[model samples]
Target: MIEDRYSTASTLYPYCRVSDQDAEPRRHPVVIVGAGPVGLALALDLGQRGTPTLVLDDHEGPGAGSKAICFAKRTLDIAHRLGAAKKMVEKGVVWNVGRVFYGGEQLFEFNLLPESGHRHPAFINLQQPYFEQYLIECIRVEQSKGTPIEIRGRNQVTALTDKGDFVALEVDTPEGTYKIEAEFVVACDGARSPTRDMMGLSFDGRVFEDNFLIADVRMEAELPTERWFWFHPTFAPNVQSTLLHKQPDDIWRIDFQLGWDIDRDKELDPSRICSRVDALLSSQTGDVPDYELHWTSIYTFQCRRMQEFRKGRIFFAGDSAHQVSPFGARGANSGVQDAENLAWKLDLVLKGLAPSALLDSYSSERTFGADENILNSSRATDFMTPKSKAATIFRDAALDLARDHAFARTIINSGRLSVPCVYDGHAHFVQDALTNGPEVTRPGAPCPDAPVEGGFLLDNLKGNFTVLAIGFDCSKLKLIDGVAVDVLCIHKPSEYLQERYLGGGKSAVYLIRPDQHVVGRWPEFSEDKIRAALLTALGKEPI
Candidate 1:
């Protein structure tokens, strides 16, 4: 049930008309705060699982502006699962090449598509608003399919209290204060997350000393083939540079570095913005082209990550959990992954299939991934924004080397730093007894997207636990009791994923959980081993 309430008491769910004087508890399975991508993604996943979710947000409509302009392959996969990927792919620009320029020449041009099989959309450049609108429509379709997802827009949560059994929320709607009670609450609010604040979690990390200006402007001058990056040292020392990205609606996103000497307040003026853009492009391109500025914002890059991603029954997703510079497009991709990581666990807990302890994996897995993203993005930031003289010298040396040598060029443009994150640790699946296998597509790694019998493998694994039996012998593994494991036999190396993953195998059998994490693997398939691994993953002892 979708409720776009300007100010109404009656709702699809159990609604009660009450003022601040006579409000009572209204319990739901889950209550989500903030209707951003992360929160709504969580809601969509929960609703698909028939878990009643109440999503509350202050804004009535989708967000404005083009904050995050990049999306990764993994995010595209998740979007495909939610049925929104097709829309995004059709509308957004597919960016497969990123060019790194130094001085006036192209220092290194990275073809990102060769490494990532053209199977996945490399990186997508799109305005955030349209991307979100597509998602909102998908959510509506999911609602029409009979999943009860209550969206209370223009209603901001004033306060939240964890009451052990359930969470109590005080929401300030247009009518008055309304109390909402739910078994769990997920906060996907932006950096200023009130839920995280209520948990008393401190976001502790480094704040970059420099700040930059982001502006969307109409351009007149012809630019290079919509390539993503431009690292020009032409304006070094003064720290003048620009990152130009193509946006929809004939606007270009321009990010420029303003040296510490410049005043941020002064840069807000249109003339100062024009001067900055002109300075960054004048020598290489030519005179300032005709342009109209649409929007401008001054922002300092922060690499701050939260102490924890979960607090009791409340969970934190998106910018609330961690924040990083937009160098490698880690911000939105990480948030989307956060939603994906959390959705399965929350579904299991809500459905009573797994104990609440299963929810603990969200913090372990997501925070680890967050730290890695921060490290990568920070490195990209450091390379992009060379602060000190020594740092600048190092960057120039690397770029010069790239220009001269093929090895150096490959080394510099590996872009392996931007690959999808692997869940190496804190997976809560690999146990001690089952840990004697070689490190070739082991547990905690993303199950290789293989093709089986004619279609993509994950397609068959839509709703069941899949047991990827890679090792040859499978006759003895037929009688696992009370546990379900779909068997897939991989005899030789797959032509599709030969170089990317460990494909040549006969002894490896992966017990894949429904959430798609490798729960267990054995050299030889055995009914007993499979049962124990599933029990352990679900936090249930074999009976």
Candidate 2:
């Protein structure tokens, strides 16, 4: 087993007792519980805005295993903004093609990176430990740059009390227990969140009876760095489905679907796992490659989420707020987006620039996102593991038809891989009344990335409210106070940009939020209308 390969020492944060003469319960602007990807990303996002953030995690360092392998384009964009994407991309494996097979017959394949003009690719595969380690490094760099982000490892929040304006917390550390208070508390702790339990919140959704065996194997083999999925492959008997994803360090993530009534212990035995791996590899290549087990985990799929993400002064992000099956890679990516969504709103609220009501938009928008992920994940799970004979018949028929017809291939749901959620009907988004711009750049959608002068459009719109003017003058527009608007004038539009954005005409203006979601767009620039849209996007005005 590859146990020591990913071990790292934790960085300690000085703790002071509440009873100490000089040490009163230290009050922070924001206290984030759980220093995983979501919490760390939130800290980086807030820190970039010069917001003071404290992140506490019970673990001494990053967790072991390649828990989340696929990082999506939207997540890489967020990571790029946080100053960690370059490292992640450098240390990860990038793949865009996924091939599906049904009982040794290649059904069809799809490409995720069919378009250009975007900086990052469709997806990159890296171990979760590496992901977390890079985020921790980013946080430290931000702290050194005077961002005031403190990450305390091995510090667990044992108790929490919401006191209206602020949330009080009791933290347990190696030294002793201490108390602290924060204007806001973000729970990024995983599914079985202590913070969620402490708040008496419950998640509601379906937990699939099917169990999956996730095995991480390191081998010196010449397998393509693409996703390979199988339905009833001849390698393993009684196995309904299998998924294989290649990660960095020659580690391959293999998932096998084990039906409901499985002996958990027997299934996880090393010998049994090795035998299954040997059979799978032999079936694929007609020869078994030398390999060694790294990590193994057995998990049941769950598509669940709390009714509301925000509860009084505390907010839940990531898996704590919602969870879905790993099939779509929605769990981590959605969590990262959740952090991005909340960080900007929380920063504004902390700086007294926006009301607490602005935070409500986070709950509403992410709840919408979580619901969409749940629906897609549940459907994929249902297709992968049919509960009834009729469902199985339909699934097999679709697979059979996929091999012959292109139209039938669209119905095949190996997993409708996660895509960014567009907050289409969100209260904060102001729809464009003008029919000049492309529908792809409609309000509430993630600003369609396009090539601009010297770099991409999204690179220029980072970290602030952006007023993007394409073939138009927006110099006369005035924005609300405290809202920093970066006016990006695209003098010469690329073909991709023209097609995806300036469709009807070249003259268009887009008002984008800090999170890069389009708030409003217009054919002609209007200072009054742009200002009103900004206010609406920030929850300061009614749509």
Candidate 3:
């Protein structure tokens, strides 16, 4: 038996537990293993949906390292949904353009605004420490709202036992061994997840054959106006290279490649590392200031994803599920997507509105996404950090080609960083049926943004299910009780979405899910079809 003072926002809620003499017994609804951004995001999502979740972490406090400086538009979208995007955007640096340089010459520059259609809030460069703090604050506010979100810092889960109906877990805190039971569990414990190991799931993937020195240092001198990336030649022969990015706090994140075969003990010496950085910077500028090194560590790139995201009632999110190279900010962004995808499904399942099969789709949809991001990120890393002699020569040749061809230059230089991943392959949605409705419409596709009387069409469609009315009269459709769907009459959409969705001059209607993903669309308004798709998704029987 063990005892601890579990306090609420106003006061700590007392929690007591008893363990079996020889074996473990069943504690909380969902016990999350890691307290990183992924874990914290899941906690906030679950908490807001009125689900009980316990987040546990081995770390004493929040991590204060400069890792994952890039945030994709999709991640920013998730943050907005979580009610923290505005604050994050205010605190972070908004970067729409980035520069890639080779041998003191500009290879190519890519701008995101044109590609993404507008100031996408697409990608921002920010400190990971501050972002984590923002999430912690959001969790605290939710806790204060009477939706209990238990965050156990300095507590580690030692063992887990699955007993069919529920899961039993043993956690070791400063006091002693403790046990808790929950209906489900989510393991976001990161790359070295003990929860994954305990569940006996295979993490099948590859660890690259090169090490990189990661450093966060305050810039000592005037920096370039753009987000600069460099591939330079050093005093050492044709060996490893560097990757650098300027962060929010006047700090620069620098990564120097150490050859794969170098000795770990000799390679990780901090003084030697700093000397190399100074040498590289000195060649670009006459003098550089002495920098205060915030953190230094030797990390190798790894491209590995878990075979499955769930082991019984225990689900995995973040690094526990998939890990990609930090190239193009895919690692953290994908993990945030995992939390967003899982949160709504988990909420629906708990509320008994959907079948358990919907939960299975979470892994299928996200794992497919993980594979895509991992493949793209791995290719980017390979291009950036070439190991073999033949590959290096090929990479250099490609860069030379990029310098000559305008389109080729953009292709090689533009970091194809965050494409909004589609869940089309997942079998949950009624895809084929909706595709046959209109020429411009497609089933299971993202709702096309159109011009309406409101701010943006999407802005007004928030909160509940929305049914857009096209050329057909909406008054003809019969209303159903307790069903929430908005009818927006669009006689002239061309006046609004110029050159976008309505450019083809066709009237269309759409049914949007609460999460803002399109469920179905049609050229004509049909009361039966809209209600049917809604009932199917919401698990309500047809009237």
Candidate 4:
């Protein structure tokens, strides 16, 4: 087993023998290989929908260190649907404003979320371990309610065979080995996924050469909660770029960009890391290094992914399917979105409500999402580390002008923060017959949250196909297959809701997917158009 290295997160799941060890190979509806945040979140999504899911992991609980700390609003929305966002939002340090600096001068600042109607904030700085812990706790809550979610700690998959209709899995435990079969298998094992390697699939993309050192120090600092980033700050002469974020429990995250080709071990020395931290503290606020070192590591960025996410009964999700630079916080957010996209489709297929072809959309849509993230990540990496002299000259010029010019500030690439992938113009979306609706709620886009009667609109779209009737009455008996489309009729929407959903119009209706994405929207509700749209969205009819 791999060591935790420098993590103090609690071991929420421990090894336990299951009856499958002794009995013949047991068959399950679904098997997820990995119990990290991505795996656990996928299991929770499936189990919450009453689908039987088994999750296996090599380790006992969350992995080492604060890996992905920036939880975007899109991620929180997905977590809220999976019943895992309450504690996370409560314990996290929420922020929306960010300041950027270049060469010891402030280069303006920006707010991620200026308008307010959503339930969650624009972003939150929470440790990765705490995020996984909250997801496990929510899974435990579901298990108590008889949700068919089971986690097998210390159970590692040794072999997997795609047998067309099912997947045969051989797992290793402390007690020895055992065999099992699953109708479908999802690999969320991580960037170096053994599952993808076993399948002999290639994860193709670019790996950036530059490296960055991360230090998580526990201290009561006077820094604001906003994200502060610098390009060639005066405090640290050796550092090329730096990033600072305030995490919960008085722990702060600091990253210093050390250009490629350095001694990894020597740079990780206690005194070396402390010197950098001390320099920043003393230069900024005239304070010494009065903080306890919590964790330290160095990492390079890789913008890579498999060509496709599905191969027969086995599918890939999260870091297993794709890997991106940490900038923009796209890695985990996109992974969670992969789970959200795959769960509803898998649920319908497992229940025989939709044709098996519906599963293909999971791969196509998420692959598109992965490509988008990789493109952005690659651009950010290129912008930060300009290869040619000409590119460096241009970047510096832009940074110089960004101090006073607004348009120049727009060109600054300080890791564009993560945002929801709008599946706009995708073929899967039914062409909206009802014209002149809000583009934010267009087909294939993530439906924007707004104030409603109870609390928020997203709270009502957790686990089923929905017909959100705004400022109108929609009593359509929804069906593309045998699945029933639930309807939420809002006869009188609040101004926020009307502006977001209706585009200031009086009446509109929307078809929403289980993952809170818009299937289609119309000015008025019609049974025929809605039914046709369901068929198109479900892959039963050609769009």
Candidate 5:
């Protein structure tokens, strides 16, 4: 049945034959270590760009359980570019409203999608298994179109050695062991990363002693499609907090805060889990429904990242590069962004279109992203589990004030939630000559989505460097020597477009990267200025 959800062929690719008697090793353009969302996404991006990619996973099929349920808007946008967002959006539970409570008292409720010019919603709640299934489908479609993306299961990378020009990998499979070489290696192996350990890399950051119990239950229940978070609920007095989220197929995800001194084995007992779930359910509706326990796991909070995401020909993405507290759903969302940021750069480098320095920008840009996720996740964890007596006092006082005063509601931290990180101060961005534009659509930010002629602006810019001309003719703009540019002209701009791109009342030209990040913008289109910005974005020159 699991194989039915994700096609059997989708999960298993023919294992390559590697005899120890072979004279030379088989070489690949890119080898991705893990088949999780990040690795699969990277493979899809590269494959669509005509790069041959080989994905290796030890498991025989997609993962079990609803691991990462919350996918942010920016992540969906990336999926859209990869041609995988339709099924993800359709099968996922979309929730734009969230309510935070202190005990039985409601503090405040916030709306994430207050205004909408974008095609996707603020966030979607889909099980990680389903997410991976959709991505695998996308990969298979690309492969059908002659983009070589090989996904081999039951294959494990036992050893890795950087050879400067290429990385040598020893893979252990069911049949036997084999050796393969790749121009680049992307490690998406996850938190306990073997590749990271093989490289002798260390993650540096804070780890909270607090533990959390995540339970996924399937039952028919009448509940609003919204996120509900509680601080010090009455039913679970010993627990610090609780979170409730709805998913597809009448399944619900509930997270309970278990303090530092919890008994790991004893707490994970089925009877104990049932009791905990019943207690929370009774507290809400005074009755527990007949529910099936689909999955349960306990994990500690950690906010750590590698010093650098890249080392030689071996690159790290997803959980291999960074780990964060699940409070804000930053782990998977940030990982997807990492894959998007790196795939394009790698494609260019492999095609000899840019220098190797282009890869360094991936490190700089994604490290900036990882740092932001770490900071927000750490702050949420500290608020949830106060480290010191003063912190605990402040947290309690803030909750008490939240019940009475509207201003105090801002202090509550159930979770900050995930949003795209703007690479504002990074060296890759070029500012406008007049330095005037909407703050949300400034250079280095993910291009804000707006409705254009046929579809959303993001739809047109998929997998290509774009020149967005607003109130200006882009027909005369010449392409750079090594860069292919797709020119999108807005003959009549909408209010949202005008507000986002023409806020300064000037005709503007914007250079957008293949990843849909704005490289720079100018009041008037100049061939030389745009070319210089393109070079700067590729990490070759200063603008």
Candidate 6:
């Protein structure tokens, strides 16, 4: 039997009344507007840091349908930091290879992770509901250990006022209404954000005219666990494109591009949907396979984002801050990264360790990420749904050449699958001193994971602010900018660690941020340079 994990009938967090609902407006260090993946992840980060945080959600539990099925490696790494990757990784369908086809001809197949030493696979396919469920469960466990995290279900934020120093919020509940205040408000509400509407803000970008028929089917079939994207498939000539993905359990996700002028109601009919699925199956197995429809929906996407993610005391993350086509699996993956980036900065600002200006970097850095996702998603959408005659001709020509030439294979854009955005040039940019080091671990780039003697390199750099020494000794430096830093000195580095961190040099030092991004790197240990980099990262002056 197929289970609907996204159904609204499930009440993971039941309605509950607290002192804040009955008394004067209660204040918190941080208040999250939505309890989706982004909000829950942000709460996990802040709460684990001992920050008083609360989450407000209109629904009782996970939403209906398996919305996002692709979770990237960087996302898993962030989840590992928040203590919620085990269940997700275990329950998800892990895959690293992908095959692209053009109308009965195989163009090429590629593996996202060709090298070893990484802790997680390239990507995993898990329903969005399961993703949220694991996070919510982690929150419950953290609460047991005295993490000041509170989640109120059926509580909707109706209005909010930014008072400069803080923000006042009005929330409606099943019973009545109440008011609350917070030093910071994070909007993780989905694309049609009520918080954005309340703030009188909107996205600025292009909205393509195309519809996708998404069907989640439950059936027993023998199919390889890999991503299969087809352009101009032979099975259904009427369909422009098709995507097949393996989700957890026996369910499979299939997406059909129905173009701009599609009959929504007629296409959603069970017979019509079944026929489409049967056609796809007949091509693969030469027979119609029996299957049950677990869920079905039609979606239209837009590639857009706010000019700025932060405005006053209220901040935005996830879909509320940006919206991109679902072609690249960038929507949820990028949102999780946004939560990670904002959580650390907010922690520092609320604790008075760094200037409030540090928060500005969050906007600048994430907008950089949002723009990358938008450009890639827009390009993928255009490639899939050609608008001009020249575009179609070019795409077809590239596909024809892909059957023989490898260069043409690179030209086909079937959703450049999500990868960690290497923020090489963005605000709070720090110059790199280890010029000979691997470019993959340069400043503003996510730390590459490598196997070490103890476990993994990422596991060793365990702190909001970490000073990682690969081959030199730096036990004397403990704190930077008056904040404690997790200084990890490894003199006897393994080959993997030396290759990733030190590159061709004998030794190197790196200052990494709370989100595990390298703030700066040097060939030798220098206290003054590290201090200056830390200050620069925090948007403050060097001592």
Q: Using lDDT as the measure, which candidate wins?
A: 6
Candidate 4 lDDT over 1-543, as tens digits, reads: 433323446678899988999999999999999888789889999998889999998788888786889898989999998888999999999887889989678889998774688998877888888999999999998899899999998888989998888889999888899999999999999999989999899999998889999999998888778888899989988678998889999998999999898999999998999999998778777888479899899999999999999999999999999999999899988999999999988998999988898898889999999999999988888888887899899999999999989999889997887887888777668776556777777888898889888899899886788988878666756555688788899988988888888875788888888888888888888877888888888878633
Cα lDDT tens digits for candidate 6, 382-500 = 99999899999999999999889999989999888788788886656579899789888899899989887778888866556888888767867777767778888888888888888
lDDT (10s digit) by residue, model 3, range 22-102 = 345445667888777788888888888777888877654555555677887767666666776777888787766677767
lDDT, candidate 2, 12-53, per-residue tens: 333332342137788899999988889999999998898989
| Alpha-carbon runs more than 4 Å astray in model 6 | 1-9
Provide the lowest-lDDT 10-residue window in model 6. Answer: 1-10
| Candidate 4 accuracy as TM-score | 0.97
Task: Give the TM-score of each candidate.
Answer: 0.86, 0.96, 0.85, 0.97, 0.95, 0.97
CA-lDDT, candidates in order: 0.70, 0.86, 0.69, 0.88, 0.86, 0.88
**Model 2: lDDT to the true structure:** 0.86
- Candidate 5 Cα errors over 4 Å, as ranges: 1-23, 476-478
Inter-residue clash pairs, candidate 1: 471-506, 471-507
Q: Write the per-residue lDDT of candidate 5 for residues 1-543, one digit (tens) a residue.
A: 112222222443445544531536788999999888999999999998989999988776666765688898899999999899999999999998888888877788888874568898878999887888899888888878888898887778889999988889998776777789999999998888889998789988788999899888998877788899988877788989999899999999989999999999998998999998899888877799889898888988788899999999889999889999987899999999999999999998998888898899888889999999999989989999999999999999998888778888888887787998999878888875536678877888998888888788889887778888889686655457566878888888888888888886767888899999998888887778888888888778644
Candidate 6 or 3, higher lDDT:
6
Task: Judging by lDDT, tell me the better candidate of 1 and 6.
Answer: 6
The list of candidate 2 runs beyond 4 A from truth reads 1-22, 476-479
Output the lDDT of residue 517, model 2: 91
Better of 1 and 5 by TM-score: 5
Q: Is candidate 2 or candidate 4 better by TM-score?
A: 4
Model 2 weakest lDDT span, ten residues long:
1-10
Residues 144-257, model 1: lDDT tens digits: 888888787667787899899999888876567768788999999877787777667898888777778898887755765466455564644355456777766567787877
